[model samples]
Each structure stands twice: as C-alpha cells, then as structure tokens.
Target: MRKNLRVAAYAICVRDGHILLARSPADDGTPEWVLPGGGMEHGEHPHDTVVREVEEETGYRIEVTALLGVDSSRRTFPGRLLRRPADHHGVRLLYEGRIIGGDLRNEVNGSTDMAAWQDLDALAGLRRIRLVDAGLRLWRERPAEGRVQR
Candidate 1:
C-alpha cells in the first residue's frame, strides 16, 4: 500500500463569548459543522494558511494567537475504483485566532454553507459536525504547550 499524507490548518475563531464555525458543503448537501480553514498552499506557512482560509471561508480577517494543537485522521479509498492504493492520511494544525476585521459572510462558491457564532453553551445541545468539540475544548484549555490528545 502506498501512503499519501496531506497537511492543513483550521482556525478556532472566537468573539463575544461565542465561537465561529462553518457548515461544510458535504457531497450529499448535508453540510457539517467544521472550523474555518483548509489545506496549505505550497511553500506557504501554516500560520498564513490558517489566516487565509479563515478569511476566505468566514469573510473575517483574523490574527492567529497561537497554535492550538495538531490532529490526524486516516481513511481508505478502494484501489479498484481508483488508480492507486487507498490509504490516505491528514495532519491538521489547529490555531486560535481573533477577528481583526471584515464583515462576516460566506465565500462565493466556497465549500462552506454559512458562518455564524454559536454560543459555547449551545454546543452541548446542538448536533455539531465533527471537530467542533475538539476545537472548543482546545480553546477553553488554551494549553501553553503540547498538542491536545484526541
């Protein structure tokens, strides 16, 4: 099996006691909630990627405060249905950011449905998409060092 790795960054944007989140444009149109960000561009810094992605997704320019943590997940795609082996993995760096400016709006034709501030308490009851809890916990703890264990 051949191994393929990808790197991306996500922003944990917060303001006024609420957190900023995006509803991803899933294949089935069942958008799932996820942090605002995406894959890194070649030769681009991770910090820059997070900032750029957040702005692109949420229409809010932000300032990255610190690296929250790193997360990894693996999946398999059927080789018979494709050209190569199925094993795929991702290394994602999560960062904490504060909005600097820009009115909040969804990017045109982006992979996100909408952007909004969900109260911290609402998180407990709302059926959030994957990575919401993880991002919130990291923001709450705001660890000085080390990565958050999944």
Candidate 2:
C-alpha cells in the first residue's frame, strides 16, 4: 500500500459559552463544523501553523496559550483507476488559543467557507468532524501525557 502523511495544527478556542469553528467540505463533500486551523506549510512550526490557519479560516489573530495535546489517526483509501490502495496517517496538534484581534469573517478561496462561534451547549446537535470532538477532549481534559484516551 502507498503511504501518505499529513501533519496539521488546530486550535481550541472557547469563550463564554461558545467555541470558535469553521465550516469545511468533508471528504464526502458535505459541510461540517471543524476547528479553526489546518495543515502546516512546509518548514512551518506547528505553533506558527495554528496562528496562520486561525487567521486564514476565521479572520482572527490568535495567540496559542498552551500545547493541549496530539491526536493521531490512520485510514486507508481503496485503490482507484488501477492505483494502489493508500494509507493516510494524520498527526494533529491541538492548542489552546486566545483571540487577540481581527473581526469575524469567512475564509475566501480557502479550505473553509464559513467561520462562526457556536454555542457549546448545542455542539452535540451539529454535524461536525471527529477532530472537533477530539480537540474538545484535549482542551478540557488537559491530560498530563498530552494524549487523549480512545
């Protein structure tokens, strides 16, 4: 099987009773709620990646307050068009971020199409990516080993 890897950073920014979120098209082309960050650029630190991604997807300048934890996942894609099946491994860095500046706005010509502050109480009702759930666990639990329980 072919192997692929993606290392990304994401922020868990909560305020009052809301959490910052972005709307992105999922693998199936349906929009889902996700954290306000994304994949790292080549040679970029995970810290810098979170800051840059937050601004790009949410129109907010954020300062990462803490390194929350890391979430790792692996999935395999079926072969297509005579190509070999591929294994995709994703390494996600989760950070606690505080918004420092910028207005709320949707990303244009970017990974995400909308940005919003969603009520935490209603989060369970929203169709969201698994990363959102994993990020929240990392943020709230703050495990000493910097890993979330499966």
Candidate 3:
C-alpha cells in the first residue's frame, strides 16, 4: 500500500445554541458539513493555519481561544490499475474559536461550497463529515491528553 500523511487544523465555534459549519463540496456527490478548517501549508504554524482556513471557508475572522484536542484517523483508498491501494493518515488539531469579525459568505470554488451556523440540537439530522463529530466530542469531553483516540 502507498502511504500518505496530512496535518490539519479545525475550529469549534458555537454561539447562541448554534454551531458554525462549512458545507463541503460533494466529492462523492453527497455534500457534507464540516468544521471551518483545512490542511496546513508548508512552514505555517497550526494556529496560523486554523485562522487562515476558517477565514477562507467561513468568511469569518476568528480568535482561537483554546486548544480543544487532536484527532488522528486512517483510511484506505482504492488506487488506479497497476497501483497499490493508498493508506492515508490524517492528524487534525481542534481548537475553540470565537468569531471576532467579517461577514458570512460562501467560499468560491473551494473545497466547501457554503458556510452557515447550524442548530446544535438539529445536527443529528444533518449529513456531516466525521470531523464534525470528532471536534464536538473534543469540545465536550476535553480529555486531559488533548488527543482523541481513534
């Protein structure tokens, strides 16, 4: 199997019983909601990456308040003919954030199509990315190690 690794940062911004979310563009023809974040750029700090990614995906300037936790996940993907399957590992940093400024707007032609504040109580009915649940768990549980076990 081919191996791949990725490091990303995400934010949990909840206010007024709503959670901030970005609607991911349908890669498999099924749109899913996710936290406002993405993979880090080369030479960038994870903190800076979260700020940049949140702004890009949600059109909101955020102040990172606390380190929620880190989450690690692995998956296998089918490869093309004559190639081995790909094994991917993702390490994600989840942070608590407060919206400080900027207006809400959809990211144009980005990984996510739209951003919105969703009712927390209604989340169970929504189609969402796994990261959403992971981030929320970190926010709620706040384990001492600051890492969620897969």
Model 3, 67-135: lDDT tens per residue?
999989999989878988999999999999999999999999889899999999999999998889889
Residue 144 CA error for candidate 1 (Å)? Answer: 4.8
The best candidate in terms of lDDT: 2
Q: On residues 3-96, what C-alpha lDDT tens digit does candidate 1 reach at each position?
A: 8788999998877888998878564677677889899999999999999999899999999998888777898866666577668898888888
Model 3 vs. true fold: TM? 0.94
Which is the better candidate, 2 or 3, if ranked by lDDT? 2
Q: State the lDDT of candidate 2 residue by residue for 74-132, as single tens digits.
A: 99999999999999999999999999999999999999999999999999999999989
TM-score of each: 0.87, 0.96, 0.94
Task: Give per-residue lDDT, candidate 2, residue 130.
Answer: 91
Order by lDDT, highest first:
2, 3, 1
| Total residue pair clashes for candidate 1 | 0
TM-score between model 1 and native: 0.87
